[model samples]
Target: MTTTTTLEPVRGPFVWRGDQLSGTDEWIFRLSGDQIAELEDAGRRFVADDPDLRFVTAAEYPLPVCADAVRVFGADLDSGRGFVLIRGLRMDGYDDTLAAAIFYLLALHLGEPMRQNLLGDVLDHIVGVSDKKYLEGGLPSRTRDKLPFHSDSSDAVALMCLRPPASGGLSSLVSGATVYNEVLARRPDLAPLLLEPWHYDWRRQDPNAPADTYTSPIVSWTQGTFSMYAGGDMIESAHRYPGVPPLTAARKELLALVEEITYEPGVALDMDFQPGDIQWLLNYAALHSRTAFVNGPDRAHQRHLLRVWLRRDVDRPLVPRFGKHVVVAAPDARQVGPGDDTGRFRIADAATIRERWGD
Candidate 1:
């Protein structure tokens, strides 16, 4: 594929200092007591509307089809960043559940109405402070910690903040397409590396698996649209392969260039979430990351967020060489071996797998 390195023009660094971000006008729908109750009733009815309850595309269920259901999320503001956080929607059951009951209900309503599976097992997969290795090699280590902007395996990803770190753990996002344009303009030579298949370490895979390494591309395009899954740890893992062509200096410089442009204040959008707020993003077109976060004073109050990955059928196709095959719905769906438990959820400790999961 031809390379285009011009980065898109930067948009506003819209900061939402507390209350300003939670107002009704910013969302597509803001539901209260009676309205929320009505939504619950409607959700149950909608669940029964489709017997099979199979996943559907955004196009399948037009705006008017679930107009009321969509409104519960809020006004659908275009901050150029297609996302919104709805504060305190009520969840009638499981009050103490780490995930706000209202968020779960809303997820179910939105997911089901869109014909997307409101996967219970998948949703439960990454809730609370369970296992991180079960997801992606537990989180990467400090030195190799930077995550280049990329989308996860889903149409839209939602996170409900039950807790926030006292410091750090800031969420950052960039428009993947915008970054692509930047690369095209400022560093055209390196843009093709994004399309080339490179290696990644499935940091969350089973220890017994023959190899922890895998390969995929940084960016993929279909019908002129773009999607990405660029991660530093994954790219570094490729170096282990003997005889594999080394990443040229130009490639390295290009990557560093992309990183610099994408993370700049004018191009990057940052947000700090609070308890009771549910934030959702259209992952297909946006790249997201979280700065290193320190948990609260105690384990019980440690930084916690409920994550969900939803597959939206309307998005671009996965590039063949990237190996986009998915065996499970959520990150934690992988089966754990006899001694693979490290008790640590961070990927930095991944090197200790052999010692921890001794034969």
Candidate 2:
């Protein structure tokens, strides 16, 4: 495989701390009462014009935006610094339908690429709940728990905060390119391991499907840009095969190095989320984590966020190991249900996913 020496650098606005990163109170689009009404009305029009467009569908699909909205969202911002957190929206008064609708519209107007099968594809949404097992497995909660740096599957992932944990749950972000560059400068020998293919546990896949594992690289450069999807557990799991070295000492070291640099204040950013505030990031360009949080007494008010993966229209080529295209099976071929075969799965179909939500 050919590797390009010049990779576009990863860049972001804030730095990461142990449980918090520097963040701006400024919002990309702060809607006033009139602006909110106009936005809601525009959202309704967009949805009505396209009946198939649901909250989850909008997360997966891209809708044409008027030049005005794009300008308001500042689409011209650097791709590496794609994260924008909108503040001052209220979720308490809105029903699930309206809440989802607003988030979908905001995501569409942002125009970031959807990585997962969002619109025309299947499974457009993912709801993260606080579970003991899942939390232990590295999913973020509201309780100020430290999350390891990792990338989700998509060009961008947007999380709409419906509720915040009573304490903690601060959001953190780090640039993958920044870490890679640090490694290259400090430990050049480990840099190449990041470019090699490693296996990942397909957490979203069918349980019975051959262990639901796929292999890809931690870092890949296509054309002049960089793309990364890294996780510790997933890479370690690749050892299930014979003849595979024990996590490749270099890989482990590289992961450690990347994590160290990412946790630094110069490279990471932290922000506290409010209800109705949405945080969106360019997944390929950056890595993000969340602090563990403590939820409220009422389960309904527990920390809740909606996730949508997007594939954007860009000139970047697919990395060989990362596998650029979305893979789908016939609906009939797989069991269609509210949850995965494991019974804990949450389907992303826009129209029916909310019904399947446990809380």
Best by TM-score: 2
**Model 2 / residue 359 / CA error / Å:** 12
What does candidate 2's lDDT look like per residue over 1-359, in tens digits? 12334333344442223233344444345556655665566555644554433233433434344336445444422352556666656666665456666676665565432323211322243334434344455233212356677777666677777766677777777766667778777776677777778767664332333554677888777665666788775566556655555665666777777777876766677767777787767667668887766767885656667665554555556576573222322232113322332331222234234333322
Candidate 1 residue lDDT tens string, 1-359 = 34554433333422222233434345423446665555455444433342222232334323343456465343232233456666545543423331333344455445522211211223322222323431244432221123456556445677766556666666677666677667776666677777777766553332343565667777776544456666654566556666556777777786678678766756766667766566777664567776766556764445556555544334346667543343333433222222223232221221112222211
After superposition, candidate 1 runs with Cα above 4 Å error: 1-29, 32-35, 38-82, 90-94, 98-102, 109-121, 124-150, 203-212, 298-301, 315-318, 321-323, 326-359
What's the CA error at residue 113 for candidate 2, in Å?
A: 9.1
Stretch of 10 with least lDDT, candidate 1: 350-359
TM-score of 1: 0.63
What is the model-wide C-alpha lDDT for candidate 2? 0.56
TM-scores of all predicted structures: 0.63, 0.73
